[model samples]
Target: MPPLRTAFDALARLRDARAFHPKGARVDGELTTLDAGPWPLPAGSAQVAARLSKGAGVPDGFRDVLGLAVRVPLETGPWDLTFSTIGSLTRILPFPARGWCDASYSSLAPYRVGGQLRWLLARAARDQPKVDASLRAARRLVRGGGFELVLSSATAIGVPQPIARLRLHTVCDDAGQPTFDPMLNHPPGVTLYPDWLTKARELAYAGSRAGRA
Candidate 1:
């Protein structure tokens, strides 16, 4: 188990420094279907709210980890699917930036796909761009009823394979706090990796939430 108190303390420091992504723009859409893919999600329409932001307060032109949070209505309850530009986690300080549109976002942890543990991956956008044009395009597609959110799986070696697509329908503002934690908000089929990094993140999120409260 992780030292929750220590993790919370670190999270408080990060918050105090304002070292994380602070500005997020929200959009409302619909999760139309989970196409023929690896994840075991049903194909149906569900309300969705998504938040897009650049991490570490980096300028739009610079390379930074783009953050995305997708909230979907599920039978169990409202599930928040959080993603970062990188497909995997790293211990190194100052995370590297992989282009947002072409970048692969993961649950930042692993999940059970095909009875084996794998990380959930999703393409941020279709094409690479320096600005937020891809996000604008996604918004347009959502309004036009043509946006599809595709998710994939990353292997132990960090290669991505197709999984499913969630069709976006409309756009609206998000109602919840901008911050997201995969350990607390993941869906039913998703699982976290059993490792120090995962535990640390769980603790950090708990601490951050406590600080906010």
Candidate 2:
């Protein structure tokens, strides 16, 4: 039998879509460091590119796992952070949401930051429209300041530290967006944990790229 990546690649080619988060919309944003303590992201502010998508390619009006992938320019390279709507900081499990405004998103995996493990999470505000899967309603967050970025420890203990405010500025054209791969396009400050899982995702992403071409 073929390996998992080969099978996934075949399916992606057959469908002509991503292996996961196939339906996504790109957005440009700015990251403002809230008067918070130090974190992995750059100091002060930085320009960001984001993609909001639905897992399983579910249609609108239906609850589906949501994904948030953001890229920030760094001195080392581009830093890509991928997140999924999750239940809680402790669980690190996927949670389906009705809309972009009401979802709680987390890394769904562990990361090492400055030699310590951490998880990135976000909670959306209600001002945005509900049941709009396209995330167009959430654009208000960029100007109004509603999206909150937080960081939690690997143990899932203690309160999550506030990182920064991530605001979606405008929708970006698909032709201009960069291919985000958290596995490879990461800055020095963030490192995916567990050697085995990292290798697995690396292979999966490589296969996904092949199928797309």
lDDT of 2: 0.71
Q: Candidate 1 lDDT (Cα, whole model)?
A: 0.59
lDDT of 1 by residue, 128-201 (tens): 23334244543554566444557776667755766565554556544554555567775676666666766677
Q: Which regions of candidate 2 are displaced past 4 Å? A: 35-38, 89-91, 125-131, 135-155
lDDT winner among the candidates? Answer: 2
Q: Which RMSD values do the candidates have, in order? A: 4.7, 3.0
TM-score of each: 0.70, 0.85
> lDDT of model 1 at residue 163?
53
60, model 1: CA deviation in Å?
Answer: 3.6
- TM-score, predicted candidate 1 vs. hidden true structure: 0.70
Give one digit per residue, the lDDT tens place, for model 2 in 86-201: 76434467888777767678887777765567777776543544446555444444445444444333335666666677777676554454678998888665667777878888
| lDDT score at residue 58, model 2, on the 0-100 scale | 75
TM-score of 2: 0.85
lDDT of 1 at 200: 74
